[model samples]
Target chain A: MKALRYLALSIAAVLFLVPFYLVVRNGLVSEAEISAASWTFLPSSVRWENFAELFSDPAVPLVRSMVNSLVVAVLQTLGQLLLCSLAGYGLARIPYRYSGVMFYFVVATLMIPAAVTFVPTFVVVSTLGWVSDLRGLVIPGLFSGFTAFLFRQYFLNFPRELEEAARIDGLGHWGTFWRVVVPNSRGFFAALGVIAFVTSWNQFLWPLVIAQDQESWTVQVALSTFLTAQSINVHELFLAAAVSITPLVIVFVAMQRWLVRGVAETGIKE
Target chain B: MSHARAFWLFVGPFAAGLLVFVYVPIGWSVLLSFFDARNTVTPVEFVGLRNYADMLTDGPFLRSLGTFSVFAAFIVPLTFVLALVLALLVSQISFMQAFFRSVFFLPTACSYVVASLVWKLSVFNGLRSGLANTVLSWFGADPVAWTVSTSPPWYWLVLVTLRLWLQLGFYMILFIAGLQRIPPVLYEAAALDGARSWQAFRFVTLPQLRTTSVAVLLLLLIGAYQAFDEFYNVLGTDRGYPPFARPPLIYLYYTALGSGGQDFGHGSAGAVILTVLIVGVTLLQGRVVRR
Candidate 1:
């Protein structure tokens, strides 16, 4: 039984890992080698120059898109963290009129699937003159209802004494949040931040539609153009795929603990 | 600051963003659904449910919903079983738990576009050099055109496997958390009552996992309905999108945005219809699960 278990695991693990390995292997090889009828498990020669070739290609804007993706993801993460955290804290802790109505409104957004609003949201962004601009890419996605919901759920469980102590020490609500609440909830913030950042980075249809011009494309949008471009370079495409996945892999490796924890919290909750 | 002031100060921006970006668009979409808005958001003519009627009766659009049903029917159960089985298996092992967990989860970091590229160009590509064909050649079998052939509909294999690789691990993590919450004492009690391991699992573990299972199924259902990236990336070609597997989003996108005509009325109508379907299904499923 134990042996069978290990075999199942090892097989699934290999299946999961093969595509990643292929991306790396094909990335560093020549185009002829990639298209060769006889398959090779490894590249004969490492072509580090594919990176340079990819970046230098006029049609493929690798560096600019990567920068755009980074900027968009970072700004989106920070925006979600600040806006959702504040909203969540208020919903959980503050006593005020219209609290129920406000909370209901936020939660209702979660039920309205993205497909329903895809075109109209595009219309909204376009009407605002954000089409083909980073603002189009960043602003619409800045405040997620799901993120706020998660934060509100997390804050409801927070110890009241911490805020009370901060209050007694002469911290106002804003001061208490910035000084005490924010500092204490680093893990939750990091977990949600990782989610928001990865989501923004991996976003496809929105970026594909909104960033119409080549200059404003995200890495995902850029990688897509490779497939449909006039000239397809298999090796360079693989290399580009490899390059695109690098930042996310790094983030996942570094922040996986918090991510797992965050997943757990969401799963077991009512 | 006073409590009222603090509440507004904190939640105000989020509420405003939600109203502008979410609720208003929904209202606009509903309004657009009733108008003769073609190639423009502002319409001089109001059509009054003609758009909604057109979408409901449109063969391709309705078939797109059927495609969603097929996708959801396959993916929801497959992912649930695989993820649950993986969670059970991973939780049983003591050594290198974290390694196995991370190995499975690492793919969650990958984007659908990147994965689709790899799958299309190398893995499932129709050439003899493609990974699947290469393996088949070794086995003395003919190479199959995965994405191209619609008779056998081999594209489903490409689509489903890609989604499985990208998503299975994340759900496994959810099940793992659910598994961890199951008390070992329950298993002990079952064992003391002379129940076998399978029986213990059926009674103790499965019942304990009800909450997580429901949540996972709900999420998987919603996700299956929302799928677009892999379909657009993998099946798409210079010729055009194949008719067999275009989900509602792709259909709506082509109607409203992809085509130069920009038939916003029909698209908005389809969107509203799809939204109602999704919410209705979700609510129905919730009721069923509760029962």
Candidate 2:
């Protein structure tokens, strides 16, 4: 029985990893090598020039795009963590008259697809002249309804006695929030942070709409432009893709523990 | 902190962003649906249901709706079954659970635009160089233009397969999480009571995952309705023209942004109707799922 389960899981793993394998394998093969045959499971030789040429592509500033992605992801995650935690803490802990209404207002945005707001958001950003700016990219994403919902649900189970004891010590709301609540909710905050970072890094549509020029483009957008350029350079394009997703894969691995906990928590609740 | 002041401070940022970025835009778009808003930034003249009326009579718009409904009908069930099967298999394993979970979930992190582009260029590249076609050729079948071809029989299958590959992992994670919540004691008890593996799953696992199943179904339905990036990136307006590959949301995007003269009013009307349908269906599903 144990051997059967192991064999089944190994097959599942291979199936899941096939796409990533294809990306890496294709990235190493030259144009001539790729077009010679339909598809090869292994490449005859690794073309390291693809990665070198990907960095040198003049149409896309790959390094700049990576910087833009990192800046946006970091800033957005930090802002969301603070704002969502505060709002979630209030709704979960504080006794406010309109708490339920406020919670509903936040959660309602989850249902409102981003596609519905695309046109107007473009108008608003254009009016502010924040197009091609990182602020435009990060600010709108900071207050995530999904993160707020997640944090609130997790905070609901937080022990009330701890906060009551802190209240007895005369710590004000801000003080209690910063020192007590946040310290205790580190796991939840870290979980939410990973999610925020991943979404911001991988986000395409909003960035594509706002960032008209290569200078402001995120990594994903830059990689996409490389793919759609008139001269189809599959080798370099695949290399760019591999490079673009490397940070995400690294982050996923580093935060695997928190991610699993977050998924388990979020899922069991719903 | 006082209730009123603290409440505002806590909820103010979220409310402002939500109202301006979400609710207000929706409301404004609904209002714009009644106007003859052109591409210019000037004030739009109110046409008072002309756009909606036009849509009612528009053959392509109606056809797009039918195409979207058919796509949703096929993709949602196919994805659900695949995800459920994968989840069941992964959950039964005693070790390597997290490794399998991460492998499946990693694709969800990939951008839809990139995925669609890869599918178009590399996977389904319509020539001898294409991956899918090459595999089919091994079976002595000719290569088919997966994206360009809009024949009724093939179009639906191609669209569903693309969507299924992109989406199955995310739902699979949800199912795996749902599976974990089922107590092991139930299974052990079932085994002692002479319940077989399939019987235990049917009796214990299925019922425990009822909420998750409902959530996944509703999410998939709403997601299918709103799908645009894949269709836009993979099958552009160039190929499979007129009525076929155009889902309703894609139609709205094309009318508003495509070269069809940029009638914002008509597009907004389409968006408004799509939003209403989604909201209504989601609410109905919510009630059903909760029950």
Candidate 3:
């Protein structure tokens, strides 16, 4: 029975590992080796030069897209963290008359489907002459109601004594937030940051529409241009995908503990 | 500062961003749906209900919805079953649990676009050299035209497998969380009665996971309706995607932006319709699931 369990698990594990294997193995081989009408489960020889070719290909510079993705990801993450945390703190902590109404409104916005906003958001961006620009790609997504809701939920459980202590020390709302609340909430902040960064970095459709210019394309958008029937080469495409997802894979492996917690906190509530 | 002043100061940035980006666009979408708009928001003609009427009558848009319905039907159940099985299996194991959990979830971290492309041109590529075809070769089967063959929809095998591979891990974790919340004592009680494995699962595990299963199923249904990235990334070309591969979102995008012409009026109407479907289904499902 124990052996049977292990065998079942091993089968499941192998099924899951196929894609990872294809990415790593096929990525390291040449185009001829991949398209030879025979399955090569293992690479004959590691040809790391496919990635070099991908990077140096003037059509879609993998390096430029990575940097572009980094800029968007970092700015958007920082922006959401700052903005959502402020709103969440205000809605959660401040003794304002309208906080309850405001909190309800903010959380209610979370239910609005992304499809409704897709076109009009584009209209607004194009009207603002933000087409093919970083502002167009990054700004519209800088604040999310769901992220703010997570922060609000977290802050509600935060110890009130910290705020009172800050008040005793002559700290105002902003001061209390910066000095006391933030100092103790590094785990939540890291979770939010990692989640926000991964999301922004991996965003495909929004970037695909907004960043059509080669100079402005995010990594996923750049990787997508290779899928056009003419340019579709499995070897380079796999290498590019392997390259594009490497950072996220690294981030996931490193902070998966917190990432899982963040996903749970957001998902189970819904 | 006073309460009102501090409140505004704290919430000002988020409120400004949300109003300008989120609220205004949504409000504008409603108004845009009424007019004969094009690439620009400047409505070319005042055509109230015509845009809506046109889409309602359009065969392609309706077909796209049907296609998406099939996708949703297949995906929601497939993911629910697969995620639950993996979760149940993982939950029982004690060794290297976190390692296995992360391995399953690692794909969820992968971008959908990347995953889809990898599945299409690499694994399920129509060529005999493709992984799926190569695997079949050993079974004395032939290479399959996956994306191109809409007659029997070999593309569905591509779509469903990629979607499952991409999404199963995340939902599995949710199920695991749900599974853990089922206290061990219930199982002990079941064991006390000498209940068999199937009986224990049926009595103890199934009933306890009701809320999580509903949440999982509901989320999967909603997500299936929003399908675009995979279909577009995998099946689409520089010109356009095949009819069979088009979901409502992809269909609407092409209607709005395809070189045929940018018909934001019709597109926004479709968007409005899609939004209504999402909200209505969510409300209906939430009521059902919660009750």
Error of 2 at B258 (Å): 2.9
Off by over 4 Å in 2: A1-8, A264-269, B152-158, B237-243, B259-261
Evaluated with DockQ, which candidate comes out highest? 1
Docking quality level of the chain pair in candidate 1? medium
Model 2: chain B TM-score relative to the native chain B: 0.92
Per-residue accuracy of model 1 over A40-147 as CA lDDT, tens digit each: 777788888887887888877888999999999999999989999999999988899899999998887777776557888987787889999988898889778888
User: What's the distance in Å from true for residue B141, model 3?
Assistant: 1.8
**lDDT tens readout by residue for model 3, A1-270:** 766766787788888878987887877898888777676778789997777787777766789989999999999999999999999999888888888888876876666656545777887788899989999988999869988888888999999998999999999998999999998999999888888998898888789878978899898988888775537567877888888888998899889888887777666664
Give the residue spans of candidate 3 off by over 4 A. none
Standalone chain B TM-score for every prediction = 0.97, 0.92, 0.95
Per residue, candidate 3 scores C-alpha lDDT tens digits across B196-266 of 99999999999999888887887787788878888888788877677666888889878886768888888
Q: What is the TM-score of chain B in candidate 1?
A: 0.97
- lDDT by residue (A114-149, candidate 2, tens digit) is 765666566556656788898788887776777778
Candidate 2 residue B58 C-alpha distance from true site, Å: 1.4
In candidate 1, position B31 carries an lDDT of 87
Grade the docking of candidate 2.
acceptable
For each candidate in turn, give its C-alpha RMSD to the true structure in angstroms.
Answer: 1.4, 2.5, 1.7
